[model samples]
Target: MTADISTPSRALDTDSTLPADAAAPASVTFADLGLPATILRAVTDLGFTIPSAIQEKAIPALVSGRDITGVAQTGTGKTAAFGLPMLAALDPSLRRVQALVLTPTRELAMQVAEAIETFAAHVDGLQVVAVYGGSPYQPQQRALRAGAQVVVGTPGRVMDHLERGSLVLDDIRYLVLDEADEMLRMGFAEDVEKIFGQAPTKRQVALFSATMPPQIRRVAAQHLNDPVEIAVTRQSSTVTSVRQTYAVVPFRHKTGALARILATSDADAAIVFTRTRGAAEEVGSALVERGVSAATISGDVAQKDREKIVERLRSGALDVLVATDVAARGLDVDRIGLVVNFDLPGEPEAYVHRIGRTGRAGRTGEAMSFVTPQERGRLRSIERTIRATLEEVEIPSPADVSAHKVRSLLTQVAARQEAGRLSMYQGLVREYVTEHGIDPIELAAALAALAVGDDGPRAREEQERFEAEREQARAARRTADVRGPRREGDRPERSRGVRRDAAGTRYRLSVGHTHGAQPGGIVGALTNEAGLNGSDVGKIDIFPSFSLVDILAPLDADAMDRISRARVAGKPLRIKLDEGAPVSRARTARPTGDRPRGAHGPAGRHDERRTERREWAPRDGAERKPRHRTA
Candidate 1:
């Protein structure tokens, strides 16, 4: 494949009248780019049917073995744009390094190496080595000595190898500088130049950058000869489908607050971003402590561990991931529904990139930021950069968290019921109740409360504190909203309630573990469908076969109708009561047929006498009901 390296279009305005290069005609496929059959087969296996814009334009130029300069965004699949052709152009028979790709950070280098390996999987006998700082270099040196055809490394370590004369690029035929602009920003321009000087002048050179700065272009002119230039434009300032939200969380409570938020969010998979590698580990550990399956990725993580973590995230083995900016580079997970910023991003560009992890490939996503009072200015800066306002969300209250958990439990129960495995549990329940002389309702309530961690004092205290803080935050936000810019018709709409019930109606749903239902999903579905805020929802009881949700009584008939028809986890909820009847009747019904045959015969006289005796029993009474026997 050859790039159309036409002469420059116009001369410089100055005396240096250098003609600008003409753009090349767009190619459509990897086949058009002349990729080897082996690489094409690998692409097909990877499920990439057609070439991306970068791939179509860059592959041809790269395969032609010409010096190329590409300007593209991070998520445009630039790694493969150069990687495929480089692998195809490799001389597998040769023992020495034939290609060298330098990245600004170790994470990017590892990513490039992994990508190259994936593309070259079918190309037998291809050895690709990734070398970076902060680890033993002997292993890398050994791999190089044994024969590595391609070397992907960070500039600092690559320079170290060059200085030590451990790496020989004299035989190198291709050189790639990925994220060229970032390398320059990191003060690696001098090192890049020095490294480029070491490679053969006649070698094929490729420089890929997200942005075209004067410095990057100068490097291109100095190193690349008659290079083919390709620029890929961003589709939009912000991904339209991503729901951007932020919370003003204090720095000290940010980690705890993030855990709570994640606990309450309807996220399948999430990425938590931190400014530093250490913070990634810290936040990841915190989440793990809170019983979330989590992993950390950063520039410092071993290549093997990073790959494993990425694999886990992709396979849904891990639900939450904490990563630094550089560590998350080249990650392309389709199931990542949420991206969180534990620390406010220092640059608006970084924020864009962080949030861009979600809302990928036309899929809807969410990006949430935790901003401290001091970082309010930073939040404004981010808003200005994205040219949009981020909706301020109140931190979820303890009640909200509890409700989410209950819904999750109920969803799990529904799933279990759908699986038709409730007979075993039913048997266990009957036997337990018979042996203990316990009321089934009381036993079920205890079990449900236990499952959702609804212990007495601690749970109440936590809920109270969370509610207080949430109310304070909401008040602050309402005040700010009143003062901030408002649309012409931004007045609050009057809400009408049809009735007010002293006690809410308890409606059941057909969702549980069998349906892969989570508490957050149920809450989200109800909140969205009912148009009632999370706060309006009450107690949630998750049984093995189903889940029960509390709705305000004097309920909006229209809302209830909508909820009954609504689909949760693709299943329409019966939305009635435990007895499979309307909520109104169930609320007033008394339990029948279930009375102990013992001391309380058919009549309720013995039970009433026992209750009276127990109530009259003094603290000093010698005979007392055993703690476990007082049903």
Candidate 2:
């Protein structure tokens, strides 16, 4: 059957509108933002090409010495928005706490402090300290005395510092409230107010929030003076490449349900969001028990320890992260392929922020929330607020888990075979067969039985039970289908089709014969980096300069992000969709004279030179050559 496979649209339609002036790019560069040359150099070294919308709008206003209120969504480069300008304005020579940034929780405080340190790396004699509860105050007090010009901390610790005279904000020139709404939600409003009162009146203040509730607006009105109000609307809030869904699982079975879901779903790395610190710990431990490499992040973790966990996650050493709302703020891991809500967030806004972690930049991501039976109403409320309906998925069965395990075992066996180490095992088996005078088939069957473990019968029984359950689910789905299609009046409608399928869209990748790419190489990379399997991947057509591959739609944003960051053949794959016209137009625009010849190019010219080179090259290297050269 000829499928109607086309490239999917990349635009995200949102109700949020951008300011008319924002359409024009800001003329300012890192140097123009009053940042010292050292800091600007540092930013360049970190691979940032241009300031994001929030940074462009908030930076200059902040540098002009005005109290500012910035309303921007998560992942809009808010850290650099405040960090770069603040660090540039700092007088490193003055050791007495010149700047104080208050975050809602310890995780955010640590994140802010890390960003400050990163931006201030080239600046000599700059001291940045992060203070929060759950740790000894003596070390923090010592750091303050030893001279920290920039202080990033939670409100409670800042208050404690003020009371103990360990941190003197009387000399503070710049005060920033990062994620002010979160602080208020965490009941740190009174502490924040007290901290504001402690600071000098001449200080410049900056309040950045995702959403400005009435209370946040009132606080901004009271604290900021004729503040330059910069609101970055939801135009940027539409993360285009992310495909979001939710699963309705009871609260008691949430942990088991999450495990089952992960077992069946294709995800490279996943982040499980919980409501509390304790929940993060409990869930993380449970995932580890189930053989998943998982870790937890919360307020209780030390700064050094949190950094270690985050680093491991980025490096793929950890596949799952369980974190609370406060613990996960400012986390930007490109490899996160999925975001799962083990427990529904208390607030609707928190739900948005939780899922926002996965789909970032221009990559596709998947967000799944686990809703309890009682919490279905709350889930509906969240759906109404976001103006999006979530699709429900069934929990995976034991058979699914067994299939995954068996596939993994086979893969390991294949790898061992390729490594040419099976000779030892072959000899051992041959000796056993000859000594026992047993039939080769019987011997092989005995070996296979041993490999599958002594409890193989029990495993088969479990698989049978799981298959029975799957049959039941299929019957139920058929019943639903027979009931008739959902009508518009059905309040919230269900999402049709499989979650694994990318909805029948094609994407283009910058890797092909030119990059030593094989079908297996592409499959491995997609599976390892995006958590997709070989079955989900469609047709792969390799061209000289690039390749086009059919991906199941809608693509997962987190998975795409991981693919973007992944390296194949020691080169970064700059992949995107062809969308037909763009590729055709570019190809048409190219002059025939400029086009390089493939393996089947004209003879007697450099074609022979290319052919000779290909003949001398290794098989892998030859595969990287153009088709004309290969011929």
Candidate 3:
């Protein structure tokens, strides 16, 4: 199991200095890499004109069937660096798993699977399947049984299938350990080692990690053959063309701040990055409610729908796209003039990737991040990672939004006056002024106020509320500064005094008592998948063939999409808003003395008399619970 791979056969440091005459070619296309026409065509179709630093170096070695250890940060196109070459070398005609890629999280597993699927689109019979925890096993098992040529999954899930005899690595010719350091950090080292042992001894291996810790080095030396080592410099320099800045905004007001920021921004289009899919849905819906043209894309979005959404952004039909990191990976659009971090990313590397979405093709772009009072340390970390201090900027105020709108309106008015197309409008205005015996200038002013939507009392009230909140936030910071260094628990809770007592909307789920669906299971699914908090769930009534659940109102499309895809009792919960009248239980009614037909005696209440409690057994057959991180 061990090899003398401490010193690799070849070392390629992309950041190393080279003589002017010996430098890498200015541009190297996929075709120049000697890939098959099928892969080349697919890459070209995806609009990839040149390989990234990692891709330029690693693809050739990978294509040569050499094991590689790549040291690169996120957002360096590592997926393509490994995926393109892997696709080129895979045996499409084979009907078993020839390539096995292990990721640290389900989000990454799905992302890598989708990227590889895009690369293998033209390679006939090259089926790719992604298996991960927190999902049912039936579908993934069926995918494996149906002869998937490539398998991508989290280590624990993959190990589970291997133990169940559903996934055999006997034919695995290519083994990839992506984000190896993350895997080790997430406690997947043992599972990874078992998988490595089970795979074919004579196989090409690629181990990519942002940092080469001692543990990762040990794993690489023990498991990999004499491999080529590749290192890509951090992406701080990649985003030099991007003007990075941040705003200190409270979490509750982020949506309003984002709407105002977008309204005032001159960028043609923007992408807002959130830390989770649920945040994406919430932020996007809030933007739309604020009259901003916005859409959302997350892991829940279907591939075709995602493609259409991206196309809309490119075509300038959509101005704002709210997305999670994995969902927006490898997204390219020339018109993305701005990037907004709706929530600060957990890692600086992720911040780099999120901002890199813009400032492509030598074009200048702007990246703005929202920082809460507690997130100052994270902001500093990003600054250190980027090797630059981000400019602290103010969130656009309501006045700023009004001024921008007024400027736009005045510009239109001037254009119309210059074109001499406002004669009818002028006549109508004059007639109105004459009938009311009002000053013409005052009438014009009133019309302008109406045009900019600045005349209403509601608008004035909202503006005052916004200013008051901002002032309170400033006062809190000042008090914190004067008092100095309080314990975390000493900090006061931030609340808007909102109540959750209102009855939320009702939705029907396809799982019920007959399907062994319990109230606990339904609550878990809603909180875990749709990002609903326990308090957001209102009522649960389980019928024989279906269930009615009440969740907080204003469920956005993205949340609904996630809920629809969620599985309970090993079945898809085709959730939809309950539009029909309540289901009548008259036929199933029993005598007053008998037990009720539903899971409980009444709606919104669980059976308190039932004392039996069921616990989950570890599915991976390990002594500890399976570890996973999607958010």
Best model per TM-score: 3
Report the poorest 10 consecutive residues by lDDT, candidate 2.
Answer: 2-11
* Model 1 lDDT per residue over 1-631, tens place: 1111111221100011110111132335455679889998766544344555677778888887777888875545677888888998888989999999987665556556766776786888999998875446699899889899999987767876787778999999989999887666544565687898888888888899978889988998898899998987532256667899998886667877887888898878999998766678888898898899999987556555776787788788998989876566546677788999997764555676677667655679999999865356567767876789999887776667778887888888777888896788899999999999999989977887787788979989988777777677668657655665322223211123322222245566776435544454455456534544333454444433456555542346666665665544556655654333222222245356444453334333323322211011101212111111121
In angstroms, how far off is 155's CA in candidate 3? Answer: 2.6
* lDDT at position 320, candidate 1: 91
Pairs of residues clashing in candidate 3: none
lDDT at 191, model 2:
74
RMSD of each: 28.3, 26.3, 12.8
For model 3 the TM-score comes to 0.63
Leading candidate by lDDT = 3
Candidate 3 or 2, higher TM-score? 3
Per-model TM-score on C-alpha atoms:
0.52, 0.50, 0.63
lDDT of each: 0.67, 0.64, 0.72
Supply the global lDDT for candidate 3: 0.72
Residue 602 shift from truth in candidate 2, angstroms: 99
Candidate 3 stretches with Cα past 4 Å from truth are 1-28, 92-95, 133-147, 160-168, 238-241, 248-256, 271-336, 342-364, 371-378, 397-399, 421-423, 437-442, 453-457, 460-631
Please, what are the lDDT tens digits per residue for candidate 3 over residues 1-631?
A: 1111111211111232221111255456566777789988766554454566788889899998899999986556688888888888788777899999997766577667877887776788889998876567799999999999999997767877998899999998889999887676544666788899899898999999989989889998998889899988755543678899999887778888898889898898999998767789999998898888899987667656887888888888999999987667546677888999988875576787678677766679999999876566668778877778999988888878888987888777767777887778878988998899999888777777787788768778978898889898889778756755422222111122322222346677888666777665666567545544334554455555676665654567877877787766666788886653333344366665565556444441233212222221122112212121111
